[model samples]
Target: MNTFKDDTLGSIFFQVMRLHHIRSHTLMGMQKIHRGQPPILGLLWDKDGRTQKEISEELHLQPATVTVMLQRMEKSGLIERRSDSEDLRISRVYLTDKGKQIKDNVEEAIKRLEDECFDGFTIEEKLLLRRFFIHMRDNLLKVSEYKEI
Candidate 1:
């Protein structure tokens, strides 16, 4: 029998499984938010009022994709877009009353999903894991920026 310590393939498979498990739970939690609402809610959670372009940049999504999502969200009464006071050419997105009402529910769902993800971790372990992930993200960002230059 192959020992785990000697199985690089098993380690890689375990990492993939962990990633997929987190992603699946996250998607399921997002699905609970009213249809056509996740991205708008996520943006609003970060900043209640922002331009569509700003949202796209913050979320690392394309402006065109954000526009289409916003249009759908607006049609569904989850968001409203108004001309920017300082820039008439720019449209700022804001959550509607209905959208605000669902914010708590969405937040709760996310919290639950996180709890599920970190079910067995100690508080210190969780903090350490978060630090490691953040460091990895920063390292990758540096690599990407270097490649762009």
Candidate 2:
């Protein structure tokens, strides 16, 4: 064994996040959606036809970034941007049929990943882990300007 057997909390947090990113990417690839699109897709699935500005605010992303992602997703046939008849300035995003099909696929993928990640973990351990993760998130939010939503 190496002298430095790294067991730091920050290291573990990074390892978990990295693993989740990898898994999410693989899952999205299988579903034929971009990695960044799931967050948007999930938002739309929960409430279809949200404007880019609303999405940017809800996801805490820049409007410019959301615009770029929406363009890519629209080209992929996953979403459509429509002009708001009442408010021409605001455009609402709607999911295509293909995008609707992807909802269940990604949900299953997430569940599969969760099961794999938490395999053999007891309920108590899982609860404790969730609490710790939330606490860490709260700490991060405090350091930044983001408030709990």
- The number of the candidate with the highest TM-score is 2
Model 2 CA deviation exceeding 4 Å by range: 1-5
Tens digit of lDDT per residue, candidate 2, span 1-149?
33235568767667778888998789778878778888899999999999998999999999999999999999999999999989999899999998898788888987888998999999999999999889988889898877864
Clashing pairs in 1: none
| Tens-digit lDDT string for candidate 1 (50-103) | 988788776677788888888878887888989989889988888888888777
Q: Rate residue 131 of model 2 by lDDT.
A: 100
- Clashes (candidate 1): 0
Question: Candidate 2 — worst ten consecutive residues by lDDT sum?
Answer: 1-10
